[model samples]
Target: MKRAGTHRSDSERIDLTVRDYGLDGGIASAHTVRKRRIRRQTRFLAGLAILLVLTAGGIWLIKSLSGNTAPTTESSQPTTRPSATTAATVTPHPTSTPVPTPVPTTTKPQLSAEERQSLLQQAGDEVVHYLDQVTTGRIGIYFQNLVNGESWAHNDKMPFVAASSIKLGINTYLYSRVAAGEISLDEVLRYDNRAYPTGDYEAGTGTVQNLPNGTELSVRETSKLAITISDNCATNMIIRRLGGIDAINPWLNKISGIVDYRQKVSYTNYAGQSQNGRHRTCARDLGLQAVRLFSLWQENPQVYAPLIEDLSHTEFDFGIKQGLPEDLVVAHKIGTNGAYATENDLGIVFAEEPFVLCVLTEMASAERARKIQTDIAAIFYEKVASWPWP
Candidate 1:
């Protein structure tokens, strides 16, 4: 008998379904055939029932599990979501890339050769304005700073009949001689009446005759009086002691860098001299002289310190020193014979930014000249206050 619940080939099944014949063909063994067919049918029905039960159990399990799970939403695509803590721990790209920027090269602007000349020409415009104001009488003026560089009015080339201001040259020369050991500052210098010379009344009657009877004074005292008070007698005495105007020439040449710095003794004394102040000076050169004096203070501190310190001792405040702040020092020398005719002040005006002024004015009246001096000084200080130095 064929085994029940076993797979049978199609040919075998068909063969089993047909009645098989024994060698003797009687009825094909009726009882044997019936029993074999019944067993095969029972095995097939049991397999079908077991297969249906298994299918139904599998569907039930799937549906029951799906009911307890999260519902599917439009936004819930099948993707792996990272934990919030894990996302927070991750580093992110910077909003902007850290690109290396090329450093900017800074180059100072260079002025063309012509541009330098033009700058000076522009400064000249202001000079011309003042020059126009003093057209009535000869006008001279200049300005500069060793720190500030050079600017001019009738510079060294344009000579003015330097009046008492010439004492500046004399004093500077004498100071140099003393520095060189040619003269002793303590050496007593005598004043012979002949050493004093007389000039126009604008130069004045002088004060030499007023010196104490046959009294001798040291070179130091006389220089002080000559420079600080502009005593004409004292100046003449020093000039003679320094070996006359000729002795001052070599130094003057070196300083002025020109041959025109001539000194002709024009007075016996400067004290009480009418101050004809008519002594002429280019506006610019006088200013430069003042600057040079200040520079000397800087260059030879030991030698010039006292002199510069003593500049505050200047007695005349009517010129450039007028109207300036009281605290600021003005080391200046002023000259004017009468009113607006000729007025000049050469010296350094110290403020935050110090500068030298050499202004010469020959105005319509001495009063006008004085007024111009005051006005110009005020204007200059105002302008300098705005300068870049401070």
Candidate 2:
């Protein structure tokens, strides 16, 4: 008779199934079948071993009860000693085989590359539509996902009055040099005509002017005031320390990857030199500035985190910040020139999906600029926050 539960042609049937699956698939199926066969063989051998041990014990018990261990002989020989117990000796159980651990699978679902690109495209459309509906005059925007390399821009290369946004570059250059040990924070700089090479004196949006001419502040204090209060005097102090616009502009261009970052121009400093802020920057370049600073902070968080901290506490809150949630932390610098009708904000937003965003607008009044900036920020933040980021 054939086997009670298994057919004689089980392997043959499995072979037929593998052939039906085709050459490529047959290899995978065969691998699985071999593993199953090995496991079954291991179990069968263990059971066979237990059966033999039991059978031997049963025979020994019968001999011991019948008193028939040794065969009868004509001459008596020396008898072997008996084990002291009346019961038969039994075999111990074998240790079990360990099962291999399975690899863990990711719990969260992931988006395909095409899907991610499609969604980002949709976001860009929404942003452009919003701009068409509301904004007027020259406007430029740059946004980049820090998590992924995907980016979006609208007129990002267009030049705009840098206004106070240059503070981002000035302070970043200062912090980077300080980290590299090229400059020290304790070094004292004076607020005088030296900071204003074009006979400029602090007059725009800071408190350093209130301290009077020739007021000496440490590089640390000046850096703090320049960012937090948008202090023009403090900014000039930093600019002078970095060797002024001629010295600072090249470094800014090289690191920011922009041709025109902060070109030198005549503007009023303290004591009524002139009444215009002439520094120039654009949206994309400003975004690069923030991105580079983010890299520095990543390299040595302790050394660069203070700059982020200072950016978080800046005085102006009407531009990009006006759109974000109040609870989240946003480190940014604001630049404005009511005279030139230029307003801008540069920032690193720490969102569910963090990003660098820079928005620059010239010829738009302060009120209109605020609305345009905050609204665009809201739209982008929604898009980034909704992504199923890997």
Candidate 3:
């Protein structure tokens, strides 16, 4: 019985062993199939990755060549505006060019000669009425409209003491020489007491006399002093340099009919004539001088620039300027000889309608003369302001 049992166990063991071996072989075959399937999947994934890389590279190269990396907004389908209702529609408006508006121009009023003469006569009568109130002294007035050339004169031919107004002739002659290039404005001049002796130094408007002897000044500087400050010493020096009244008279007469009946240098030995006769100028003549000077300045500004500039700096402003608006400019010169009781102002008024005025008074108080001047200026200003055009 023991031998038979042992034999049975050995058979059972052999059968179990064969079954185990079969199971192991089946597992090995299944593992080999799974490895093959994995390899095939890996190869397919790699090929797909390569295809994607090549497609991306081609797209990048095309964008680089075209220089257009910005995203495009192009659509394959046509777009339509949003509508509240499906049946709603839109219509485009017609386009057209616009026309500009035209601008209008201003025109000036023209007056007849007879009308102008009548107006001038009316102005003269008004001025005469104003002068009638002054019972004490002789007054002369000359006025002319620079634009229309209409003029009026009241005792304008009567001569008065020129006083510092003679400086205007001196200045005109000096500039005339400059215009002719006979003398240079840059020439240096010595102001010695001997040249304009201390005895000849008049005690009036000036600074050149107060300056030390042997002081040097250019012709231009001396002229400026003569005109702007009515520097007596400076005037004498210029007159001496020009060779006295004889040298200046011919030039004055030759140009602009400006007649100075007795032209004399200021603060000189020969300047002490009678008050009636010392350096006399008529209102008409002085007015003409101012007109000529303005014309000269307009014609040759380079030569007359200094004279115009000097006149613009007139230190005395109690005459025509007092009556004028501050905005207006008056290029003027005032002459007052208290010894002779003469007061005169000649100037070009740069009003809307410019004019020349010369007011000469004798035997009147300074205040009265200034009042007459201011009134005369106001009359002209009113006339100009009321004029129809600029």
Candidate 4:
């Protein structure tokens, strides 16, 4: 029985050993399967890492290439306007251009003789028409061609009071006296108290100054005063000094280019009378006086040069000067009275071709007459100066 028992133990031991071995085999197989799976998984992870590296490298290369091709894309994209400017360098753009301005010219057409004459006649008729509107009495007007030595007068036959414009006639006579050496221009004379019977202190009447009862002035100065200011006292003095009334007759008759004469009244008798406003001449005669003065100024610029120069410095602009351009220099005489019927202006306008014009009017108001004369003179200036008259 012991032997049998021992053998059984050995068998049992053998079985146990087999069982242990089987268990070991089983654990070993599991370890082998697990190691194989781990190795496969490690291999797969390595391959995936390589693929990912390759993909990242490719993306970086592509970006670098794109950045090189388009310079602004790597940084921020450039603005649209800047992009347009850059594109313009590669491709030309269509653009609008600017235009320039034009200049002015000065050439004008020349007028013909018939055209000028017709213009003058039309201008004269217009002047006459204008004058008729301002005067109820008579509107006497005259014009002279100083260049051609011709004259025209409407109502030339009638005589109006010289008023103050006779100063021009007095000026001519005074100049004649000076030219003849009858009275020296530099000769001084005492003021006679009887000369200024109409009160000596009238404004714009020149230097007819009563001389404080004993003041003295030169004949030239007196003549200047007579003309420039129309001083009645100075005029009286000059008339007395000029060989009186009959003396001026020959001088008046001697006016050859145009002649309109009325009987000469002596200065002494004329002034002495209570009914005397008698110093008289018409528009034609006054225009003649202007022509004569202009001719005198032209012929012998030295003879009456100072007087003409002085006359050009007219301060009384109410009559003819009112209508003329301020730039024009006019040598003129004006006449006015308290009575409205006689207001006149006679003047030589020194313009393109110097002209002689006379505007005489008889109306109810002296102011109205002066305005009429001014309007007429303006018309003459407008016509003669190559300006439109109407």
The global C-alpha lDDT for each of the candidates, from Candidate 1 onward, is 0.60, 0.75, 0.75, 0.66
Better of 2 and 4 by TM-score: 2
lDDT at residue 326 of model 2 (Cα atoms):
76
Model 1: how far is 290 from its true place, Å? 2.3
lDDT of 2 by residue, 158-240 (tens): 66678778888888888889899999889988778433665326677777777766788899898998899888878887887
Which pairs of residues have clashing backbones in candidate 3? none
TM-score to native of every candidate shown: 0.58, 0.66, 0.66, 0.62
Ordered by lDDT, highest first, the candidates read 2, 3, 4, 1
lDDT of 4 by residue, 323-344 (tens): 7776666788888765435677
Cα lDDT tens digits for candidate 3, 112-228: 767766777877778888888763677888898776778888888776777887788778888878888998999988786653433225567888878887788999999999999
lDDT of the structure predicted as candidate 1: 0.60
Model 3 global lDDT (CA atoms, 0 to 1): 0.75
lDDT of 3 at 233: 84
